[model samples]
Target: MVDWAAYTLVFVAGLITALATGIGALPFFFVPDISEKFNVGLWGVASGIMMAASIFGLIPEGLNAGPWTTVAVGLVAGGLLVLVANDLLMDADIDSRTYEEADFKKLVLILGVLTVHSFPEGIAIGVSFAELNLGSGIPLLGFTVPALAIAMTIAISIHNIPEGVAISIPLRTMGVAEWKMVWWSIFSSLPQPLGAVIAFGFVQLAEPLLPAGFGFAAGAMIYLVLSEFIPDALEAGEELDGKGYRELVAGFAAGGGAMVLLLVVV
Candidate 1:
């Protein structure tokens, strides 16, 4: 009973978002350099969007689908995964920000480690599309795409822009070409399409795990924001003389507001 067409569509949606990450690097083509304060602010916005998507979109949907305990467990497990990934990355001396410095093997190793974070985001997108064509939902490409699916896709795509910038920043500093920066940014999220397809398949096969899946995605994203995004932003803006905090707050507000607006309109 699998709808291969819908599955392909979902995968494409995820892939599009992943590709959107490359667009973040486009700014560097026009500007000689972007300010550190703005970069930190962008991270703040990404953090806010991820947190909002997790809290407002993912968790509530999860609760509606299954038991509280299931969601709680998934949340904790997702957070722990991020924590462990961070430890591993630190030990390996392979943060995404410094990808240019890594040798080929280390580059591959870091990308593999990043999948721990990116794959869950893909899962979140895939799982959101579970109800495609089953009931009343937004119309897209001859299918009844769920509103949540659309929202999640947009949220994740927007959140990814800052990530692309983060990756591009270091490469830019290393004197890499603008085009290469774009390629590297897209490469960072390349796992998303595979993750989306796999998650979609799993959920379709075992409907009961849907709620836990939501929790897992939500937890991973929120934890990533708190543990990685904010800290990185602070570090980037360290020399900004208290402007970092202000930018963080402003960016958070803008991101959250934009997400809420998207949800409301959609």
Candidate 2:
């Protein structure tokens, strides 16, 4: 029989990451405007955390679970999916940067496009929990919690805060309520739970494809950092003297350091 308890725990873990996005909008509740430097830093922080998570967390686990060839195939496939999705979004004239201003229909379209990116993050969370309750994990709340699962959950949650801020900026300018900003930010990541369940189910059933799962998530996130996150930071900081590259680097270093610290602890 399938362990519903384990499934529920995993789902909850994924949900936690989704909810953490709301924390980003909490600043808007108090402040009228966030500084551009801070915004750029947030993006840089996200980039750093994601890069570390993929290189140190996901890829290593994938290699341990399966061969490097399997991981490589998954990496290529993951990046390719993002590339195709980006083209589709461009052709559709759906600019994710300005999605907060979208109407209902456009919002739906944006969410659909966002799934391509968010799904991999969810998958990363799910794949990390592949060893849950497998008799070789830390005991927690009546379950054997995999250390990797905890680490990924924390990493993704932290990574998502900046995304929430990004989503909220346009909304804040449009005079959207702070509460709504939080809701919209969470909405952007709503697909995570579903993605988590699907990936977890696949890995649990097939067992052999776990490495591919890791690679796919890692590849997708790394591609997004390069293609979207960094550019967004640069664009936002364009008015500054050095295009905010220094802030980005500083944020990246901080984020990377944080994740590395977590890795060491776990």
Candidate 3:
């Protein structure tokens, strides 16, 4: 019963969300060096935005699709998927060191590892496009555009800034050119658009599963933040002699609080 055209439009919206991550990297081309402190702040802002999107956007949407049981199952499945991926891709030896000394093969390995974390973000963007039209009668590019789509796109784009900085850090240490750093950062996030499109298409085809889709994306993202983002922040902050840990905690709280405020106001 789903309209293919509408579905395709949603998929395209997802693709745009993913591609926006690439835009975050473009800044590195112009800046001589991005400070670590600045990167940390960026990450904090990204963390806040994503948490807000998940809480305000994804969870409520999921609950609308079905009973609590459905959302619960999707959440568990999403978290499990990430856990399996982490176990499979993450090796302490490889992750313990920075990417500077890594050879070409090692770089590929790092990319693979990073993909596990980034793919969920793309999925979140894709899932948010499910309500592309809601009740709107207006058409956009032959399909109705949902307010949720615009919000998700903006949220995902904002989230990518910190991720771009994270990608650039290793490249900077490797003495990669500024522009190249931007390229690589963007390259790492290419999967986002692809993931978004696929997610949007899937949700359209299986409309009844929309709630599960939302939960799945939310679960993956929330788990990633708790498992990956927080830990990484802590590790990066370790150089600050205890001050880093404080900053990490403070940043997390600030980011989460900001998202809460945004949800209230917008």
**Candidate 2 runs further than 4 Å off:** 1-14, 24-28, 93-177, 188-206
lDDT order of candidates, best first? Answer: 2, 1, 3
What's the TM-score of every candidate structure?
0.68, 0.69, 0.63
> Across residues 1-266, which tens digit of lDDT does each residue of candidate 1 receive?
97889889988989988898899789889867658887777777767766776788778867987898998988897788777765665567444563353333333433343445566668778888878888889988899999989988998897677566655654554556899879888888887888788878887554556577678767777777776668767878888979599888888887777666654554
TM-score of candidate 2 relative to the true fold: 0.69
- Candidate 2 local lDDT, 195-217, one digit each (tens): 77877888765356767867876
What are the per-residue Cα lDDT tens digits for candidate 3 across 194-260?
7676677676555556667667767766776677666655655666756466666566667667666
Worst 10 residues of 2 by lDDT: 101-110
- Error of model 1, residue 80, in angstroms: 0.4
Error of model 3, residue 120, in angstroms: 8.8
Residue pairs whose backbone atoms clash in candidate 2: none
Q: Which ten residues in a row have the lowest lDDT in candidate 3?
A: 96-105
